[model samples]
Target: MSDLIEVRNLGKTYRKATGLFNHKEVIALARVSFTLQAGETLAVVGETGSGKSTLAKLLVGIEQPDQGEIWYAGSQINCSEYRKTNQFIRYIFQDPARSLNPNQKIAEILHAVLRYSTVLSFDQREQKISQTLRLLGLLNEHANYYPHMFSGGQLQRVALARALILDPKVLILDEALTALDPSLRAQIVNLLLELQQNTGIAYLLITNQLRLVRHFADHTMVLHRGECLDYGPTAKIFANPVHEFSRKLINSVQY
Candidate 1:
């Protein structure tokens, strides 16, 4: 149960144009710190504009932090280092259709990622692709089909297949379950838990879904306006939220 990822005082800022020649700095995240352990799911919950996505971006190296450091496996990493080392960490987007290529077959889409991320031979790549597809409840022949041929749930599984194909130590899911229906969401959540149990891959679940946070996450971190409002064991936070914002968020959930 060692720490897989540690983020310390992480901060990001963006400049937006106020006028023709005027601009203002927007604090997207400020002094956010958290630790994700091996084989654990850390749910990040927040309202819109609360810096959840910004935190995910920084975690996966999609954006550079203006301040603070990110450490993976005991060493600090800069943007460039993260780029090279990112095979150990993978990102799954909310919109599987958009994240996938319309022009390529599913096999081709997976092959592209495998080809660039690993040195597996063609035959090895194909076998790995088939194996991963089956793991996600997809058939080998399904790889010949296009992204448009699949439903939203299937497309999300395809995305998961691609992400897991890398055998990453960490998976950053940015609103990845939001697009699915309730039943599909439950299935995916169960699938995620099963995957973690089997592979020991840690998950950073960036979501606004408090129910998922309660069910799937071992720990929960609450963010508001680019700062940490509350963070602790998911059960404790849900049962008795210490922060007013956390209480409001939990109360706002319809179920």
Candidate 2:
């Protein structure tokens, strides 16, 4: 059980203009550090503006960190290199419908990822697409349907399919389950667990859902104002949070 992803003293800052020639520097993340083990889920719980999204963006190379380092598979991840070889780590956005192209059919959307990310032949790509569709419980005909034609759950499955098409070792789920209803959320959570069991893909789950964190994550990290307030096993942390902020967060959730 080696770590698949590691972050060391990670920090990020954003500057906002206040008045003419004046600016305010806001710390989006400050010296945050954690490790995601292979085949394990690490939930990052925090309120809005706690830098959860910022951490996700940095992990997926969407934004460069001002300081610190990220290592994947024991190799340092250069932001520029990551963008070119990002098949190893994928990101699934919170809103599947918005994340996907509304105008493109499902087949087109998936094929675009396959074409750009891999060197598979046309027939091979088609076979891969079919396989992914089946794995996600979607039919071949669903590929011809637009994103708008599918239900929220189905659209999320499609998004998952797109992320998995590249055979990534890790996934950054940025509030990926927040938009779904309770039943659908449970379904997706089970699906994620099943997928991880089968493929050994590690997950970095960023969300404020305490129930989901307790049920789905192996470990948890609590953030407050872009800093880590607590980090430990999910059960232990929930049972007895050492940090005041972590305790408050757990109490805020309705049983």
Candidate 3:
């Protein structure tokens, strides 16, 4: 399979005020490079402030890198140009409450996305929405309620449904399941696997959960201090990690 996405020598820096008077430059990503083959799911694991989110932002074109490049398909994408074509890339954020609108009913929310992406008539849109909702284990009645009316797990399902409704080629999940209860997390993970199997969409899953990565990811990358300290097939990396940071991360996973 050809590479669906390629990131090369990516770097980003943030200027910060030091103490009360001086300025400091914080490097968020340093010479990061990787590739995602079509339909492959890659998990990136790191502690907080490890630049995982920064990398996600860059990949999704929310932030421009100071150095290097990101190529989607065969072309190097200009940030703005990429955003214009971003229908193929969807982001599932960490907080469902914040990601969803409190005022919009689930039906309205999904209708808007379908309206934007496809030219389906009202009846077709409703049919699609109903099928998508059921696929995510959401009841048809729930679609008439506000976002706040649902549990955290249900809200996350809504988020996933919204993303999948677009039929995106790639989905970036930034700690999306971390906010859910453990059993709910397991359900969502299984849901993700089912979606991938059915649709063959690529996933750039960012998480702090090593256990989840072990169970769900095809490949895993360990980030530390803005660099990829280790990465490989999930099974091999977990079985014999060479880097101390990677070892610590693998050990930290509960059971």
Candidate 4:
């Protein structure tokens, strides 16, 4: 399989605020490199403040890396460059409340995205929106409901449906499943696997869920203090972790 996403010598630093003149810099990601092949699912596992979220932001062009290159397909995209057909690189943020508009109905929210990003006509958008909602196990009756009216789990499903409406080639899910219950999480995971098998879409799963990583991810990368500590096939890495941080993270997960 050809490489779909590539990162080389990636680095990000945040400057701390100072009173008068001098300020210190906090490094988020330091010299990180990896390759994600087409149709492959790579899970980025890390604890809080370990640069996992930072990596996701960089990939989705939310935050620019101070140093490094992000290559999609064959071209490199930085904070300044848009990936080839970049709109297909969809990002599902962690917080449903924050990422979604509370004032908009589910149908309205999805329709707006489809209208702006897709070329589908009004009738086509309606049909596609309804199909996506059903695929997510949501009914048309819930379509007119505002986001705040739905439960957390429902909001998450809606969010996933919105991402799918674009027919994305690469889905960057940043802790998107963390807020869900275990049962719902399993269902969503299964849905993701099914979608991948059917569409050949790749995923950059940014999560701290170690067990899920072992089960669903083809490749796994562990981060600590803004650096990659271990990366390899999921089974091999978990079966015998070479890095101490990887071992500890695996152990920390409730089995």
Best by TM-score: 2
Question: Stretches of candidate 1 above 4 Å error?
Answer: none
**80-134 in candidate 2: lDDT tens per residue?**
7886558989999998888898889999998999899889999999999999999
Q: Quote the lDDT for 197 in model 3.
A: 87
Best by lDDT: 2
TM-scores, one per candidate: 0.97, 0.98, 0.93, 0.93
Expressed as tens digits, the lDDT of each residue in 84-194 for candidate 3 is 557788898999899898999999999999887688999999998889999999988988999989888888999988988877889999999888889999999888888
lDDT value, residue 184 of candidate 1: 96
Q: Provide the global lDDT of candidate 4 against the true structure.
A: 0.87
Higher-lDDT candidate among 1 and 3? 1
Query: TM-score of model 4 relative to the true fold?
Result: 0.93
C-alpha lDDT values of all predictions: 0.91, 0.92, 0.89, 0.87
Any runs in candidate 4 off by more than 4 Å, and if so which?
Answer: 78-86
Per-residue lDDT tens digits for candidate 4, residues 1-255, read 678888998999999877688899889999999998867999998889999999988888778888888888888775556543446788898987898888888889989988887789999999998899998889988889988888888888888888888888899999998878899899889989989999898999999878788888999999998999999999988889899988888987777
Q: How does candidate 1 fare on TM-score?
A: 0.97
What's model 3's TM-score? Answer: 0.93
Give per-residue CA lDDT, model 1, range 84-121, as digits (tens).
66789899998989989899999999999988888999
Q: What's the residue-level lDDT of 67 in candidate 1?
A: 98
